[model samples]
Target: MYLVMRKCDDGFRWLETDLGLDNLDLFVADGVLVGHLAWWSAPQRANVSTGDGAISCETSEIFPSRGICREKTKRGVAPSSPDCAMANLPHGGVLKDLYLRDAHKKDALAEEALRLPAVVLTERQLCDLELILNGGFSPLEGFLNQKDYESVVQSIHLSNGLIWSIPINLDVSSEQIVALGIKTGARIALRDPRDDIPLSILTVEDVYRPNKAKEAELVFGANDPAHPAVSYLHNQTKEFYVGGNVEAIRSPSHYDYVSNRYTPTELRSHFKKLDWTRVVAFQTRNPMHRAHRELTVRAARARKAHLLIHPVVGMTKPGDIDHYTRVRVYQALMPKYPNGMAELSLLPLAMRMGGPREAIWHALIRKNHGVTHFIIGRDHAGPGKNSQGKDFYGPYEAQELVEKYKDEIGVEIVPFQMVTYCPDSDEYMPIDEVPKGTTTLDISGTELRRRLRLGLPIPAWFSYPEVVAVLRQAYPPRLQQGFTVFITGLHASGKNSVAHALQVSLNQQGTRPVSLLLGETIRSELSSELGFSKRERDINVQRIAFVAGELTKAGAAVVASMVAPYEEAREQARSTVEKFGGFYLVHVATPLEECEKHDREGIYKRARAGKISGFTGIDDPYEVPKRPNLVVDWSKQSVSQIVHEVVLMLEQDGYLGSS
Candidate 1:
């Protein structure tokens, strides 16, 4: 009996054998005999051909081949070389490995890098550079030049007509452009910001300013500050972008997740060794849970493919769980899957939260990593909500966008089906499959955080105990966590006295260590050279916020008192400190006359006499708190009374227990 299998447009081929051959099976990859497929059971013969050595089997399932580089199967093209034995071909047909592995060549480049002007890479830029060097960002030799950048921003395609959604440009200040003499044809050293170690030397091809508004509007769907990427572009990104091709001296160093960090070439080789030709890649920046596991397993099973749990380890959403904790969660989830069915790997990707556009970008990245299929879930890479609290994108917008270009991308899009737990069956099922009026349970991210904060029980069916244990360790109950009380007002508005009283009260309560960040004391110790200009004050307040955040993360109660007149600076401080712990902004609202009257040091008098220029509330303005948690007037409230009120607020927020 002879069996025939033909490649299908969906990147899978059918298996066929005569009923006469019950015990044996054949494995064919691109019409070439590779091995024996012994895993399938006997199937009934659907059709028989006597003259032609071919028979059709009853099994219509699309089974993946064991040893074949699945290229664009719809194109019916065969692998070009023997080297393409397994794994999917990288996007754009080539895996550009830019790493100079030869010892002598690397040494020469490293020495040459010393002579060129260096641009220290930001965290996000380092992530991009690493991928470029390793070919995870295949076909991208280096940062995008002006032509390609404009094309990508406008049409989600490179200037060459290749689909490249996100623009990868080396952003720099105008000062750096002049100081480093950066322009077309100039060479500059790209160094790691952490250690100043040279990683690559780049030959600049184009230097230009990007139209951020146009880019944000077209690429991100909105130019809203609430979108993290838009906010970053307007607030943080430099003025000029330098584009160039880089010759790598060395890849970026990563001490953690060493075993799981695989370059594109290495990953393809590993997949080939495992004889896995069809891979389904799961992308996540958040920690995995039972729902995620079910979704991925179902997708893989439906596709008859192995699973790759690829999580982003670089900058994610600002408040997302740290990669270390997320990695641990993923590790905990590995054993839950059937053995040898899944693998975990870290992708050092700096996510732009670009919603639909980012979905295509992720698909291309996975395709470059030899992934045949990618899972695009609801609101994939979404940036939460806009300033008006409406979702930035529809739930299925990412899936629809990915679906529109899946064939062109050469990576099948597996739309993630939302799963919920059914206690009646003690299992998870897709939300659509669950019958109406049936009891179902699900946890939202907000609810999970609330439960974790309040030390509430998380049902075992929702997540594994091992995973919950890791999360609990990372996020202790609110009572056990620390908090910061930030006081801001005009000078001598009893800010220091209130801060001191709060510190003493907290210390006496003894739930955690207490830290006091008094403005004058900080000025002498940490900001002696910083004058009281608006800019200097912002810097001083930012330094105070940094220390307070550190203390809060260390499980300490911090009371920071500063004249922080500008609301923007105060808001910045709140954002910084709140990442680690709770932040309470206490506005000391004593009248300006009352403050001047209580100024024992005559600083206000000196400011009135023009001795102190830019004295807040005297020469400079003090923007009143727009959203203070607690407001106290020293003329109406005593220090003890204010401390008691602050303590009550903390207690109510569950930051205090038996204290």
Candidate 2:
């Protein structure tokens, strides 16, 4: 006999089950059942008795936060909850379509919007608003108020007891709060940042400064900057959260993929029209390939359900492929699918990459779109790695969490496994199902990107020609692509000289156009008004990075050399430039004493004499990069040698080829 523990409102109760030990370990590990009476044998408020290797809870015991065990049938299988069986129902038993469809109401709301203080939505906020207005984030009428926000962060549930894992909040800067006089009961117009079009009017319910550290730790599982979402939470998000009810005047306009943009109601209606009662949704932010196709097809066939290709078109992890390219790839794959068995739609979701929490959130969103099952793959919605280069979540953590909450989410979890191509059979099969010693083949994402950069041929077995064509157009050979070489050092550390030398060397190649952005040149032209404070220096570096990013995106080589002392500012520059193309950080590690000795401009002399206050390497600090692509002590090495080393580094990284 095994002991079954289930969480109740007061605390917990235990029931006996006749399941064998063989099934208990795997079942408990899957988070479906809890056993091993030794762990819970201790008495709490009331006496706990143990007999026949069974532990019983008499009074109240708090359930473990990892998971709550479900009651099992006689056969030891957890029965699907009644609410989960009602697959057609939306969260909260209602599809809250908040868009104002009536012409008169829309006109009146639009007119009133012109009079209220307007808050232009950022791209991420706009994505959140679109989902909220369309019921894709149903049971949520608007941005979550402080109560619901705290509720979600603390318990992964709303104050109303709905299982909403992620918080939907309108984060605004403190300046906005002061500028707009935002406060409780104040109605503000939510305008689109693109065209200043009023999309909704929100009635402010709460304006509060969120505990961002707590939210980052609880919702995202950590406050480490290595996780993209955690980094964004602390770096990009605003200081205050404005939560309220939003009455939509219209939906955000999407000119691209007009036919593929489906609101939750519209998609559900389309599925009904197609007589698709059991639809399984596949969520992706990347381009789908052969292995993906095989996995989705196998999952759909196994479940006997129709397929929906739902891809996120909003903010994903930084440095991800642009949505335009990914969407094109998805559109190209439509013809590859069996015509009536599958359909495609776009979800404008600002993904937080919250891994396990995000997996449950994705499932709920799909459920709102009438999906009966969601295909959750390993590390679903995971932000790639942490600062230590370790995965933030276990590979199967998302699958396990989603399985634990699948009943309440009302969407069946389809756990995805790695599928490998078997050359012997000329077919793809799950890795576990392939016979031992069978020869198998696969192309990793890293290898695929390497092939794309080097202009090497991608095997036909890995991806279709049409899809490859799209990817190739977007990611051209390194010879045709752009790159940025960011050089940073002390004030007189020869960074500018090295940058100029590198520019000349690259220009001599005649492979790409080269632009030089020297620190003094940028200071004279772009940031003359900024001072030498830490904040001002960061702003100046960001300005240089922005220009470099634009030039790189336009297919030009950018050499930005600056006395960017702070490690954070340098990293910010790298992040900015890398979004477009290659970013090589070259640290001129010329010693401060050597730089002071050279003292070309006498700036170091002034710093020593206190003529220049807050000067780097004097009063302020120069935080050296822990891991730069290349390092050069220019006091010892000549500019030509440094430039050659930089070029060689670039060539080795596939950003450039031998010339």
Model 2 reaches what TM-score against the true structure?
0.82
For model 1, residues 1-659, the per-residue Cα lDDT tens digits are 22333333332243444322323232222222222222433432212221233322222322232211233233232222233254565666555566622222677889999999999999999999999987777668789999889999988888766778888989999899989999899999999998899999899999999999998899899999999999999998999998888887898889998999887767776777778889999999988889989999999999999999999998899999988899999989899999999988899999999989999999999987888999998899999999999999999998888888777688989988999999999999999999999999999999999999999999898889999999999999998998999999998999999988888888888888999999999999999999878899999999999999999999999999988999999999999999999999999999999998999999999999998888888889999999999999998999999999999999999998662
Whole-model lDDT values for every prediction: 0.82, 0.81
Give the winner by TM-score.
1
Clashing pairs in 1: none
Choose the strongest candidate by lDDT. 1
Off by over 4 Å in 2: 1-87, 100-104, 386-390, 589-621
Q: Give lDDT tens digits, candidate 2, residues 327-394.
A: 99998888888989899999999999999999999999998888899999999999988878888999
RMSD of each: 10.5, 13.2
